[model samples]
Target: MDEIIDFESLKLHTAAGYIRASNRCFTCKAKRQHCDYKYPVCSNCAKNNTDCMAWAKGSKSPIPRSIACYLEKRVAQLELEAHRLRTELNPEHLDDKENIAANLSSKPFSGVCNSEKDDIGDESFGFLYFRSSNLPAPFDCTLHSSDRGNIRTFMARNPMVDIYSIPSKIADIILQNYLDIHLPQYPIVSSEYVRELKSSVFEKRNTCGPYEKAVMGIILAMSTATLSYKGEKGALASSGALFSYFLSQILQVEWSDKLKKLQILLLVAHYAFSNPYAADSCYAMKEALRISVEMGLHKELDFDHISPLIMQTRRRLFMVCMNMARHVFSVNKRMFPIPSELISFQLPEAVDDHYITDSGIDLSGPPTKAAAIHFYRFRLYETEIYDVLWGHKSIKCGLKEWVQKMSNNLDSWLSEANHFSTINQLKYRAICHASGHVRLYSRSPRKQWRNREDALLLMESVIKCLDEYLVNASTGWLAYLMAGVFHVEELTVCLLDIMWNESNWIFDHYSQAYISTQVIQCIGLLQQFSLRWPDIEKSKMVSYLSNLHLKITSQLEHGFVIDPHIISQLNFLIFPQVSTGYGLDSLPEDTVDLDHNFIQMQQWNDNFTSSLSIL
Candidate 1:
C-alpha cells in the first residue's frame, strides 16, 4: 500500500505457471482441474462461482481450518455435561454413565411429559433422562409375578372336587316339585325317565353322564330355590353354589348328543326366565342354535325308520328351543340366530304324557293333548307376532292392519284353546290376552288415538290377567314364581304408567280416589305375592316393587292426587320415561266405564275402607 502498487493488476503466479497448476486456487484444487492464473481471479473458479483463495508459500495459509476439531471439542463438552447430570440425578450410578443411560432407556414411563421445570429430585432426573433418550418406554404392569402364578395354579386345579352331591331323597323331592310345577311348561325330559331315575337304587342309578348329572343338578337347585327352601341357611347357600358349579361343569364338558345338549341349554334358558341372576340365557340359546345346526335338527327327519318317541322328542325339543330363542331375541331386540328358511320340522304331536308310552306316542290321546297342541300353536303365533312387531320381517300391510290381523289371529287361537280342559285353557288364554295387551302397550308410542278407551281396555286386560295369575299362584310354585318374579314387575309398570302418566288419559276419566284405590289394590296384590314367596326378596323386581309400593302408599295416605308434574318427577325415580304421542291437549272427554271385577279388588277395597272408617 505504501509503494502504491496496482493491486488490481497484481497476479499471484505459482512456480509451475504459465500452464497454471490446478492447486493454485482453492476451487481448482478441490475439483482437481487446471486454472488460468488471470489477475484477481482464476477461470475455473469464475466459471463455477467459487471463491478463489490462493495458498501462500512459506507463510501462514490463507484458507480456514476444518470444523472437525471444533465438533470433537463440543462433543467432549456434551459428554462431560451428561455425566454431571447423571451423577446429580442418580448418584448411585455416578460410577457408570453407560449403565445409567441403559437403565434410563429401559425404565417405564409413569407420568406425562412436558418442557416445564419440575421439582429438583429423582423426578426431575427422570424427565431429563426421558428427554435425552429416543427409545420407547414400557407400561407398568398391574399384576405382580406371584399373583399371576396364583391365578395359573387356581385355574389348573381339578373342578370335579367341588361337585356337591345331594342325597337321593332330597334330589327326588326337588325333581318331583319341578315335575309338578315346571315340567308342564318345559317338557324336554320325559316323566317316565325321571321316575325311573328316582326309583332306581343309588349304586345302579347312574343313567346319565356328567353333563346330564350337571343338568339334573341345576334343575333341582332351581326348583329348590323357587320353592323357597326354609331349611338351614348353609344348605341353601350350598345348593346355590352347587348349582353354579354344576353349570360351570356343564359349560366345560363336550356334549355328544346334540338333542341332550340343546335340552340342557333350553332348561337353562327357562330357568333364566324365572330367576333374576340367570341373564345369560341368550348366550346359552345362541350356543344351542349352533349345536342344533351341527346336528341337523333343523332338517326334517325320515320318521319311517326312527322310533316315534324319538321323532316326537326331537320335534318338541326343536320347537321349544325355537320358541325360547324367539323369546330371548324379542326381549333383547336381537336378530334370531337361525334363519327361518333353515327350519323344516313340523310342530310336535298333540299327545299327553299318559299316551307317551315305551312303544310310542298315541296320536289320539286325551283332549288335554289338544290343549297342549293349542298351547304350542299359541307359542308359535307369539313368536311370529314378535318377529312382525320388532321388524325382524317385513309385513305387506301397515302397522294398523298388521296389528288387526294379529289380534284376529290371537282371537282365533283363544277360541281354539277354549275347547281344551278348563284349567289349562284359562291359563293359556290369560297368557295370550296378556301378550296382546303388552303388544298394544308397546306400540302405543307409534299409534295415536284421541280417546283413552284403548288404554283403559289394555289396563283392564292386564289387570284381569294379573288377577287370574295371582289366584292360581297358590296352587303351584310355578304360578307363584311367575307371578312374583315376572308378572309383578310387568303389572306394576303398567299400573304406574296408567296412573301417573296423564298422556294415557287414565286419570281424566277416573277420579283420584278410584285410581288410588286401583293402585292400592295392585300394591296389595304385590304384597300378597311377597308374603307367599318370602324368597322373592332376592329378586331385583322386589326391590323396585318395594320402593314403588312405599311411594304410592305414602302419597295415597297423605291425600296427594296424581298430577302430571308430580308423576314426571316420580317417573325419573321409578323408571325411565318413554315419549308417547298422547299429550294433555290430545286427551278426549271421559266416555269409559270402569270394570269393578277387573282387578278382583272387592275384598281389598272393603278392608281398606273399613280401616279408614276405624281411623
Candidate 2:
C-alpha cells in the first residue's frame, strides 16, 4: 500500500468526504452551504459575521429508551425538589388565593398531559402561569409603582413655607368657597370633617394631626386656585405655597392607614384635576383603588353584622373609587384597573349626612333623597357602558344591534333623570346624553349620515352644556368645576376627525364652514376655561384645536374644486406643524410663506402628472 499516491488527490478526497459527512455548523446549515469544518467556528459563518454553533454527531437520532427514561426521571426529581425548596423559603408566594381560584375555575388543564403514564409537571406550575397572565399589565400597574421618588425629589428641592402666613379670614373664605362649590359635587369628605378642621385651624389648635392639617390645607389651596383669577395673583401665590407645604407633609406619611391615605389621595386627586398638576390624578386613582381593594370594599359584606355607618361609608368610598377609575380610564384610553365583574358591592343608599351619627346610621330615618345619588348611579351606568364599549368581550351582534341596545339603555337612564330635579342633575343628564351621542358616533361607520348627524348633534349639545355650565358657574363653584373637567377635548377631537374624512363625498364647502365654526366655538370655550383656570395646563388641548382650526381654514381658502391630489400635497404646508412644546406663547410662526416655492413645485408636478395620465 506504500504505492505512490498524489498528495493533491488525497486532500481533495478528504474534503469531499468531509462535505459528504454533513458536519456543518448551525450557521452553515442555515445558509445551506458547505462548511470548512473549522474548530470553534466555520469559515462561512466567520466571513458572514454570524454566530456558529457546532452540531453534534448523531444528534438527529433518537435517544435510547433507557437513557430517555433516566433523563426524564432526573428532571422530574429536580423540579420537585426545586418546587419544595421554593415552598419552604416563601410559603405565601401564591398569596392571591382568590385569583388562583378564579384561574382554576376558568382554565382547568386536562389530566391527559400528566396522566399515570406520563408525569409532565405539577398543577401549581399551570396555576402560576395562568395567574401571571391575569396580573395587571405595565401601564395598568399604576398602584404598586408610583412617582414617590420624583415627589420626594421635588419636596427636597422646594422647601415648604409656612401655610399659616395667609390671613385667617382669607383662609376661612377659601375653605367656605370649597365647601359651597366643590362639596356638593364631590362630597368625598363630610361637612362635619371640614367644619372641625376649619375650627382647629382658625383657633390655631394643635389638636388636628399633620395629616388632617395637610388635607385641609390642600383643599383650601385647590379651592382658592380654582375660584381665583389672574387678578388675585397674591392669593394664587399663597395657594400654591400652601399646596406645596401640605403636599410635602402628606408625602412624608407612610400611608399605612388605608382609610386616611385614601381620603388624602382623593382630595389630592381632586385638586390635581383642577390645577396644572393633573397628570398625577391617574396614579392617585390607582392608589385609591388599591386601598379600596385591600379594605375589601369591592367585595360584598354582611350588612347585618357591620354597622350601618361603616357600611354606608364603605359603599360611598367604593363608588367614588369606581368613578375616579372610570374617569382616568376614559381620558387616558387605558385598560381599566378594576374589573366590573369583581365588584360585588351595591350602590350607596340615598341618605343625608345627618342620618349618620357617631353611634351608627339611623336606618329608620327618612331617606332624604339628593341629586348626588342619581349622579352616582349615572356614573355607575357610565362605567358599565365604558366597559362594554372598550372591554375585550366578544360581541355576537351586528353594529346596529349593539348600538340599538346601548341607545336603549341610555334612553332608560335618561328617563330616570326626570326624577332628579336639581340643576346639577339636569346638567349631568345633558352631559350623559352628549357622551352617549359621542360614543355612538365613535362606534358607527365614519362616512354614514347617521354618524355625521350624531357628530353635529354632539357639538350642539356640548355647546349647550358649556353655555349652561358657564352661566351656572356665576351662581356657584360646582358648575365651574364640572366645566373644568368636562370632556370638551373629546368633542374637539371628534369634530377634527369628521373634518379629516376626505372619503366622505357629502363633505362640502358649507359643511366645512359649519364644522370649522363649531370647532372654533369649542376652542373658544376652552380658551374661556384657560381664562378661568389660568394656572391649569390646557395649552396642549388649545394647541391641538388651533392646529385643527388652521387646517380647516386653509382648506376652505383653497376652494373645493381644486384637485384632491394638490390639496392633499399642500395640506401639510398650509398649517404650522405643532410640536410637543406647543403652547400659546411658544407657537411657531406661520411657515406658509417659507413653503410657497415647495407648494408651487408640488402643484406643477401635479399638473404634469395629470396631463400625462390624460395622454
Candidate 3:
C-alpha cells in the first residue's frame, strides 16, 4: 500500500522517530466538538455512543467500538427525530400564524408587487416537509419506548405479551375513542366484539384473551395518536409504540385464524396512519388487498356456505380495501387491484353489527343509524365519477357522453342526499370534488386551456365546502376527517397555475369581482390548512397562494406590471431544504405509465375473475 491513506485527512509528522496525527475525529470536527481520536475510535464518540468518524469511511473501518457506536447513533437519531416531530407539528408554532400567514415574510420576487410586498415570503415547502429549524422536545411520536433500555428491549427481554393490561378505566376510554375516532376511517371491525371485550376486561379483572388484548392494544395506539396531536402526550408518549408491539406479538401467534390474521394486518395498517409521512400504510394495505382477493370477497356468490352476517362483513372489508387500493396505485407505483365491474357483492347494510342477522335485516322506515358499512354503499351508488371518466379499462365511448352520464348521476345523488345535514352536505360536496379533481386538471396543454372554467369551478367548490365544514370543528375531529384528503394544497396549486397565466380566460368568462373573491377565499383556506397541518408550512403551499393573493391585490388592482419571475417561482415547484439543498418534488401528474399498466392489469384481473366465476 502507498502510504496507507485514511483517518479523515490525517497528517503524519515524524520528529526524532515519532509520528503524530490530528487528535480530532471526523464527526467531532463536523460537529465542532473535541475528539480524543483513540486508535480505531475516539473517547468522546464511545462515551456519547455515536458513530466514530474513523468508522464513517468503510475502508479499514474503526474497531468494534466504532460498530457499536454506529448502531447506537442510528437509534439516537431515530429517537431524536421522533421526540422533536410532535412539537414541530404544533398547529400554533411561533413562526406560522393567523391573518393569512403574515409570519411567512420572505419574498420570492423582489421587483414585482411592491405595493403588496408585506404579505408574501420565501416560505416554499417542496411538497411535504418545510424548511424550518429542527426543534427538539419530549418524544411524542408513536410507539412509546419506556426503558432507556428497559421497555425498549421488550422482544429480547420478554418473549410474549400475552397478558399486557392497563387499568379497566383507561381501557374503557380507549374503546370509546376507537369507536368514535378510528372506526370512521376504517369501519371493518364489529362494534359487538368491542362491547364484549369491555365486559371481559372489567369482569375478569383486566385479564383478557390474546385476541381481545390485541384489539385493545391497536385501539389504544390510535386513541393516543390524538393525545400526541394535542400535545397532551405526557407519560403515554410511547404508549402507541408499546401497544403496537403487543399487536405485532398477537400477529405472530400460530393459532391466528385467516380472518383474524387479515384483521391484524388491517389494524397494523390503521396504526401506521399515525406516522403522517410517506405511505407507511401502503405495504399493509396492499397485503390486505391480496388476502381479500384470495378469499374471493370480490365475487358475490362464491361463498354460499358462509352465513349472511359473515359474508356481509367480508364484503364490507373487501370493498373498503378496494377503495384504499384504488387510491394507493399512484404514479410510478404498480399494483393489480380488483376492478369495479368484477366487484359485484351486495353493498353491506349500514345497520349496526348487533342489528344485523344471519338470514336478513329489518329496514324499518328510513333506516337512520348509519355505520361504516354505508361507505361502500354510497360509493357503489355514485360509482366514483373519477372511475367513470378515467378508470381502468374505462368505457370506450365519447368523453362527452360519459361526462354527461356522471354529471346526471351527481344530480341524482344530490336529490337523494337532500336529507343530509348542512355540515354533511358540505362534506359530501367536497368529497365529490376530490373524486373529480384529477379529471378537472387537464393533462394536455390544449385541454388545460380549454378546461380552465370547469377547473375554476372545481377549485371554488372544494374551498367553499371546506370553508363551511370548518365552522366549529375541533382539532381532534378535524384530524379524523382531514387526515385522508389534501384537497386544500391541490386546489392551491391549480388556482396558482390559473392565476399565473390564464388571466385572459378568467376575465373573458368571469368578472373582476369573481376573480378577486376566489383569490381571497383561496388565501383564507390555505391559511386555515397551514394552521391545521404543519406539513403545509414545510411544503411551501401557502407561499404560492400568497403570491397569487399579491398578484391580484397589487398588480390587478393598482395596475402594477406583473413580473415573469413570480410566475416562474409558482411553476418552479422546487422548494428549499432545511439548510441549503433543493430538489424537484411535486404532486403526480394526471396520468402516468403505471396508469396504463393498471389498465392492462385490469384486463388480466377480469379474465382471472371470469375464470374463477366458472369454477
Root mean square deviation (Cα) for candidate 3:
17.9
Q: What tens-digit string does per-residue lDDT give for candidate 2 at 532-587?
A: 34322322446645865686567656764444543332232111121222223333
Residue pairs with backbone overlap in model 1: none
Q: Is candidate 2 or candidate 3 better by lDDT?
A: 2
lDDT over C-alpha atoms for residue 469 of model 3:
40
> Which candidate model has the greater lDDT, 1 or 3?
1
Give the residue spans of candidate 2 off by over 4 A.
1-89, 92-173, 225-239, 276-279, 358-360, 363-369, 392-429, 443-456, 465-486, 502-511, 525-545, 556-615
- Cα lDDT tens digits, model 1, 507-561, are 5666656655655565566555543233233222344444655666566567657
Model 1, runs deviating above 4 Å: 1-181, 199-209, 219-254, 302-310, 332-339, 352-372, 392-405, 411-429, 441-445, 448-450, 469-487, 500-505, 517-615
What lDDT is obtained when candidate 1 is compared to the true structure? 0.47
Best by TM-score: 2
* TM-score rank order: 2, 3, 1
Q: Rank the candidates by lDDT, best first.
A: 2, 1, 3
- Give the C-alpha lDDT of model 3: 0.44
Give the higher-TM-score candidate: 1 or 3: 3
Cα RMSDs of all predictions?
A: 31.3, 19.8, 17.9
Winner on lDDT (1 vs 2): 2
